[model samples]
Target: MPSVNRLLHPSEAAKRLGVSAKALRLYEQRGLVEPGRTEAGWRAYGQEEMDRAAEIVALRALGLSLAQVKRVLEGDSQGLEPTLAAHQAALEAQLRQLARTVEKVRGLRSDLMQGRAPTVDELMNLQAPLREVRVAFELPWPWGGELFELRDIRSLNYIIGPLGSGKTRLAHSLAEALPNAAMLALERLEDDGVTAAKSRMDSDPILKSRVDEAISWLVEDGANSSDALVVLLAGLEADGPDALVVDMIEQGLDHATQEALIAWLRRRGANARPLFMLTRSCAILDLSAVGPDETIILCPANHSPPMQVAPYPGAPGYEAVATCLASPEVRARTAGVVAWRPSSGRLQSLTP
Candidate 1:
């Protein structure tokens, strides 16, 4: 009897799994497997890998991509199960609709064969009701090659900038741009404004209570419509989970606060419609200054001048700004001004 000691090459494993070796290579490219290697640097696979290969084929039969199958096998099943289930449900729904459509077509064929006078409504109304399927397309913003499209907006986003550098202006602009956005003015959050709101947002009970309060306000004000966009604005940063607060921190947000906010955003940012816009002020506003996980910086036309801009919830709405700012001509005009460093402050464009 052959024992499990036989190490299989990728080709052998593919043959055993009843799939082509090309399929296994494709899976590997997608981080599905970390194959071992022989002394000659040839790829080798173990029994575990082979088993996973079989599972991959099975999942593909169910219409899963290699990336999706790898996600399933990796045990990070948080969102995959629902997604797969949704796909199955959609397929079932489509099959039913197709069956009805086929039956209608057969009936129409019979009517035509009988030489009956076909009414316009009779032929047109035979089709099923057209359901509006929401599909999001990634549209590129003209400003600095930025891309903006519908996505799940998170409850927390870090907007880093220096103090009084038009942070609030941008934030307010975004608030106005976002339709029905729920604005939470962290009145009690700032040291000078509200010390307690900062502490309140840092805790789960207080945070939940405050969020609920904001929601209640929106509902009562008739602003909580289905298409309402919620903008959670917190002033004066505190280190805590689920708080979408931004402050001017030149070195980036405090470690604890940054981690908490990132985790919070990841969870709430999973929405499909992106109904929320998180606005806050960060001290460290340079996108290239810190690590990618730390900040999503919005750079100016030129990558220089290192001035930080607070991320307004929806201010500088990329789409609208792109329509106005979209031009290679603008960048070319501004190119000369980059080298002209001011001795005092931000430069004002003299160009008309």
Candidate 2:
């Protein structure tokens, strides 16, 4: 039996809690949990700290923000009700899916007992939810018309390349090729765009609420609200499109805003709508944060066909993707430097 007052090291405590040591460190940083320090300065989690940490983890798993968790931990129950209701609804949805799976299995078993054999395809269709959505289309201009096949389109897909790499054209082509997809162009930041975005948000109360919640969460994560961001996010959170392709998703945002925005998007989970974001900011395209439900598409500088890059250090195109991305500060510094493509006879900058 474990000692009631025994203290465990950070790694041991994290293992016991089914979380990572980094998560515990985050909890500590947020003042959500306070662990003791050993004589050698190593962190130690006692029973009290472990209980508190577990509560924080549970609250986070229920979709509550760190700020919301803090408020609930402070004995304020107002925010808890809505979060609990959301969690309950999610669980209910999962239960319904599970029920359908059980029924399918029972039916299959009954048929087997009756000497009726099911086909392999029928058995495979039972796990339809786990299947990936694949898309194939012909590549657009700047490259010879080549076939582009994208398999297992994930929740978050990043399209990245240097200027003049035809990334924008690729994004547009994807939006055109994919079913129920639309591209949110940079013109959305033009004059009167915010008004149009506001109108759309006003037309859909649920979408507006979701956007508001996301904005609040981003704000808590150190993001500053802007008309540009609001316009972009309204489209992203809107319900009509099955997928969205965004050009320069980190445009007009500072480093903190970019980081917070990406973090917020990542937290939306694997079931969220597929999003194709064109970004060159390291903050927006953090390779380390790429999950199984996220994919990176890199358009090589040499005009080779765009290929999906695995989120590992040594993967082909992985280094290219990393090279294309810059720290938000670096991106800001070089934002005005345009690539010069000289026309025939005389050196002239290419214009849209």
Per-candidate TM equals 0.29, 0.81
RMSD of each: 15.6, 5.3
Count of steric clashes across candidates, in order: 17, 0
Q: How close is candidate 2 to the true structure, as a TM-score?
A: 0.81
Clash tally for model 1: 17
Which ten-residue region of model 2 has the weakest summed lDDT?
A: 343-352
Candidate 2 regions exceeding 4 Å error are 1-57, 130-132, 340-352
Model 2, 1-352: lDDT tens digits are 2333788999888877766675677678778899999999989988888888889878777777777888889988775777688778767777787898899999999999999999998798787663256788889878899999986788999999988899999999999988889899988988787899999889889989988988888887668999978998898988788899999999889987887787678666676789999999988887765767899999999889999999878999989998898988888788879878566645433332
Q: Residues 33-137, candidate 1, lDDT per residue (tens digit)?
A: 767888999999887776666777776655443445666687756545644675577677777877887887788888889997667876775653323112122
Name the TM-score of candidate 1. 0.29
Best candidate per TM-score, number? 2
Question: Positional deviation of 332 in candidate 2, in angstroms?
Answer: 2.2
